[model samples]
Target: MTDLNTLLQSPIRWMSQATDPDMRHFLRDLQANILKGHGRHFTGNIFVSFEGMGAQAVARLLRDLSGYVTSALQQLCTARSSAGPGFDGGPVRCLLLGAGAYRALGNLATMPGDAAFQAGMRARQVALADPPAEEWGEGAWRPGNPAPDAMILLANSSFEAVTRDLEAAEGWLNGSGARVLGVERGRAQFRTFRPGGPAEGVEHFGYVDGRSQPLFLAEDLKREAAAYAEEPAPAGADTGFDPAFPPSQFILADPNARTELGAGSYFVFRKLEQRVRAFKRREEALAEALGLTGTKAARAGAMAVGRFEDGTPVVLSDNATEAAPPNNFSYANDPEGMRCPFQAHIRKTNPRGESTPKLPPEAPAERSHIMARRGIPFGDGVRDFEADAGQEPEGEVGLLFMAYMASIEGQFEFTQQVWANNPRFLRGLAPGEVPTGIDPVIGQGGDEAARTQLWPAGEGKPMVPFSFADFVRMQGGEYFFAPSRSFLREVGL
Candidate 1:
């Protein structure tokens, strides 16, 4: 029979195929943060979509995941159905996993070689012991579990089956009360990776999504373990790490050096709302300031966001020049806030050039606190909303921003508090250039519209970029330590 090692090695061996430079640091940092503590008390969270199949199949899949529950994990959260009875026009047929459920899933990672999985793996990736779904095959997956509190980005597959298959997964995520979590779409998809910048948002601007992802850490961990198991780490084991803090290490319940229930990653979840129409209205109105009339204004709007409302980045220049691809430019290159404006939404959140000196352009991957973004678009898409619906978003569209960081202060917090909200962005300003402004996107705001402070707005930005007093509001969230696969089996539920 194909042993657990071989099955596990499949994805791990091919790890390099799933990652890029930007993503490695993100996951490593995730490793550090999760290892910092057991994260006993669950807190942060965010859920994602999965491609769907059919009902009888999906409904059966959902039942298998929720078959059992534990006590410790249950106190944290509960999982169930989104739609009322079954998966008809159900709330998209989902599986809401709770902290308790996640903990149970983690244990599956350390599945023993001689365990039932031995026969199971030999049978197929997906195993259906009973009439219901059972194998961890292309159709069936693992325990729908959670990994260590570190950044593994490990998954059985990447393609999510929301309309059909994910009904089981949705149960675990939405079911949990804690936060600090998200699911990624991958081949042999499993929840072994760390999600950042809205924790793997579904769509960037207007793409089908599951497209843009990190550049760091490999995708398959089984392959990595097998490859590096024999080879020694380079001379400076901590080669690319920081001198002041170095990298973080985790201890698990293993023969090499066992520790019960120790060393796991975390899952952080956040439900962020996006004001599509409001954002558009503001952008459209602001375009007038540039004096770009009609077609010109349309271009101006696209440029302001570095992309068209359709999620097409302006940097692409219509695939003409690669000089500036979307999500890859410096706002200061055009200090007038002309090309990619000081108040552009993406620019504000990521603030590429705003913190130049602080960032090592030579090694964009060097920064310790920096993280990768995995935001998914939530709610309804852009649509005309009635004026009265401001309290309740018009179309119900929003971006779930999730980031995995070694240090929340530097990675997550800094990005949100300073870069995204801070006004006097990039140190000194050009003589004639106006002060930096608040990020038009996630930047906060208040009751009155005029009170809104953006570039070329009320009080020319200075100390605070935008004067959004009560704009983006937090709906629900939670944080939990995502343990490694081993920790789940030996010391956990």
Candidate 2:
């Protein structure tokens, strides 16, 4: 027995030691230094909480946590680091806070000073004043807990500096009564894809991924009662608090939070091997069997997934050209799935409206899940290998798939179990069927239909609309939680 209870309490214990108003200043200096990082190999992430700590306290910790993070990052930039010839691809960017960082505000009752308490209480006001969209790329923001003490971010760093910073942070946090949590060297997978080639890495059937992320202020987020009541409820929800633990699908970190919620993000890294030859052979063979030619069959295949192979959405611009504005299109323009089959890979993964198990906007059942995709393609290193060649099982080559989410069961797991890995997703079809469970880019599930997502979607159609012979493969992975900066300062040494 691993004594899961004790394991769970470890991080909390480390955090209890660093509880002081002065510790806040130490964190501020740390933060300032981190914000100034310009290293190439070194990446940074931040998490600042007010949980057991307070606003003046959090303000204290936030001011310097960045410094330690930056120093840790610099230590990771050495020449011996991964990113070597065979290094796996994960997020290279360090995530910072949005409004979600407020979760660290801690238990309102446990904090001190009535005046400071009031300011700390106003985090929601601060949150409403600013949101993640205002910070991350376009509408992109960081989210999720993927490992403790932000260990995963040190994937390719030197141990000496990591040790130095580790000791310093440990010293401060140990003084508090808080505990530190860690999942050192947690591994993630990355899957990559080649145009008209084999599937490998993440996001196999290529439809602009990381787009189906949860909309915090969407009409649904506001309709719920519990969602609004728990902790830092989203803007639409009335939780008074803000969602900070998982931060966003993008990376965001905090200073002293143990259960930082949405305050920080993780760098997911996975190696997805694509079967290039397999996909091409399957596509070409399917095209010929259907008595279709270049453009016609290609169009139909594109229709199966809401987008073209070049990362363009077909629903908005059914054309196969890369010029499609898939990233900025409105769902109102085309919601019926006429151009893109309702079972397309992209559609299945992010079913904006076509969900079969419909629930009210306020329903708590299906709202917990929703993640941001921050993955990239990694394979064939240079040459765009033939998709058909990849199918032959020559080994290697594919997208390095990586995703970040607040709750694995809610976001990543749901996407895997109900959408990408489940065939009957849209309505009622074989598991892993096209459109519903089709994972075109870097496949991870093992069900038969998932192996050939196109099979079922094409079965009943009178004209046999689309077919996918290719398969996406999952290499390996695990789950983790990234803690808040305060948690780290108190316990992660």
Best candidate, lDDT: 2
Candidate 1 off by > 4 Å: 1-213, 218-266, 310-328, 358-366, 380-395, 427-434, 445-472
How well is each residue in 85-153 modelled by candidate 1, as lDDT tens digits?
332221111122223333233433332221221222122211211111222111112234222121212
Error of 1 at 371 (Å): 2.4
TM-score, model 2 to reference: 0.49
RMSD of each: 17.0, 16.1
For all predicted structures, in order, the TM-scores are: 0.47, 0.49
TM-score of model 1 vs. true structure: 0.47
**For all candidates, what are the clash counts?**
143, 154
